[model samples]
Target: MKTVISLLFIFMVIVGCNSTKNVVTTDTVSKISDTVKIANEELEYEVIIIDPGFSSWIAGRALPRGYYSEAYLENKNQFYVAEWNNRVAQPMQYDSNLYLFRIDYDLTIRYGYEVNYLIYNYFIYFQNRYNQRLGGFVPKQ
Candidate 1:
């Protein structure tokens, strides 16, 4: 019994030490279906997460009816995934496979970065593929 208890205690200590506590606000929780608020400890800017299910969908779903090749979509998806992972201080803390399921058309775009254009285009592609009329903001390419 003592040996078992010691092993359990050590396991808990290891798990506890590896975990990170995130204090999410009510606003973030309410808008979770539409936006993702990832706290980047290293970066100065906040990433306005629009789609939470993008990574998983990309991993699981087929490519939408479009002129873009499967390789193109796959490459783009990989780019976004890698970029997002690099953005976060602890990549393992968040579920990289998750993507937003709903759309909030009311949220205005702010803190616009050039990379957002790429992300937005991918969002538009996702919307088109899933037939989800989300954020109607389409990209030219």
Candidate 2:
């Protein structure tokens, strides 16, 4: 009788833990879809969050130049600005997002450095990834 009672208690605890996970998952989805607050209240900026499932192909071509926000690299909402003539455009990512664009250019260089860097890096990353899918070999020319 004691063994059966112990099993029942363990099952109940497991079920309770599962239910809490479900609730938190639902809440996160709702917040991502509904929350528009910027990650930093001190920084006055606009946020354009893209859901992770969407196609980010065109968005990759539209990265801004300059130094990017550290928060963005750590899965937070961030918009970065460079003080003109920076070497490469910095890009950041959020876990639930497909692509986010911060498109304000108040710079001196006519050439878009940051945007170019982002496109190049992304291409290289994907190219490397697909190359591995093809059994990691240089095609015999």
Tell me, by TM-score, which candidate is best.
Answer: 1
Whole-model alpha-carbon lDDT for candidate 2? 0.24
Q: State residue 89's C-alpha deviation in candidate 2, in Å.
A: 16
lDDT tens digits, residues 23-94, model 1? 212221113444434332322223344444543443345343454654454445445444333433343653
Q: Assess every candidate by TM-score.
A: 0.24, 0.19
Q: Per-residue lDDT for 52 in model 2?
A: 26
Candidate topping lDDT? 1
The TM-score measured for candidate 1 stands at 0.24
Q: Which residue pairs collide in model 1, if any?
A: 51-100, 52-98, 52-99, 52-100, 53-98, 53-99, 53-100, 54-99
- Candidate 1: residue 61 Cα off by (Å): 19
lDDT, candidate 2, 1-141, per-residue tens: 432232221100001111111111111111233121122112222222232211243244323434444323212111122211121233332211111222343222121232233323333332333332112232221
